[model samples]
Target: MTDFYDRAAAREAEILSDALAAQQRRARNGLGAVSALACEDCGASIPEARRQAIHGVQRCVGCQTVQERLAR
Candidate 1:
């Protein structure tokens, strides 16, 4: 019984790890496809540094701040 429980725990851990890895990969791929031409909300030009720092960002810093505040 103890051995079976150990195996189950190991399997659960592996599944969790795989799911986390897959999520990370999807996030990276999604970010890579995002173009940093302009902010979707304000139409401001997104800075190169900002674009590089944030993956899949659609809004400029100012606009994003406002959006976060409003969400709360």
Candidate 2:
């Protein structure tokens, strides 16, 4: 009986963690989508292919790459 309860608790925690991670991802994507289609840092136009590939892409490839590198 104790083992079963522990397993159930572990499963519940796992589910909750997954749900929170997904919610965070959605929020980040939503914020990105709200940004202007043109690159925020540079005036370059965001390509259609990139917009289609990423649900909410705010920057052009070059700007995004630079930002990502700086972030690291």
Candidate 3:
């Protein structure tokens, strides 16, 4: 019983470790870890509504639209 419990705990720890690694490797919006005060591409002030709508938005609507177009 004790061995089974130990194995379960180990499995839980491994799952959490894998999740943390995946999150770290993820590329957050150009803002990095936190939301930016200004657009990363144009230096325009990021609006409160946009920031609230997209937790880590880094670009203003115009800049973001341009970037999306360029990507396409």
Candidate 4:
């Protein structure tokens, strides 16, 4: 009985952890119009599919990737 309760508690913790992570990701993604994709540096045309695939995207994939790399 005690083992079962411990397992349930662990599962609840896991679920809550996952929910918190998902919420954090959603918050980071932001909300914005799905307008034409543009480069952050030069206003270049970003592909339509790319814009559709990513949420709240502001920069081109190239620029975005570069920024990510630099961030790391």
Best by TM-score: 1
At residue 53, candidate 2 shows an lDDT of 75
Worst 10 residues of 3 by lDDT: 24-33
Task: Point out the worst 10-residue segment of candidate 2 by lDDT.
Answer: 28-37
Question: For model 2, what is the error of residue 49's alpha carbon versus the real structure, in angstroms, after optimal superposition?
Answer: 0.7
Query: Against the unseen true structure, what C-alpha lDDT does each candidate score?
Result: 0.89, 0.83, 0.83, 0.79
Q: How well does each candidate superpose onto the true structure, as a TM-score?
A: 0.55, 0.54, 0.53, 0.54
Give Cα distance to truth, residue 33, candidate 4, Å: 4.9
Query: Quick one: how many clashes does candidate 3 have?
Result: 0
Best by lDDT: 1
Name the runs in model 1 displaced over 4 angstroms. Answer: 1-30
Candidate 3: residue pairs that collide: none
User: Across residues 1-72, which tens digit of lDDT does each residue of candidate 1 receive?
Assistant: 579889999999999999999999988787767756799998999999988888788899999999999999
Compared with the true structure, what per-residue lDDT tens digits does model 3 show for residues 1-72?
579889999999999999988776664433345678999988999988888767778899999999999999
TM-score of structure candidate 2: 0.54
Clashes of each: 0, 0, 0, 0
Best-to-worst order by TM-score is: 1, 4, 2, 3
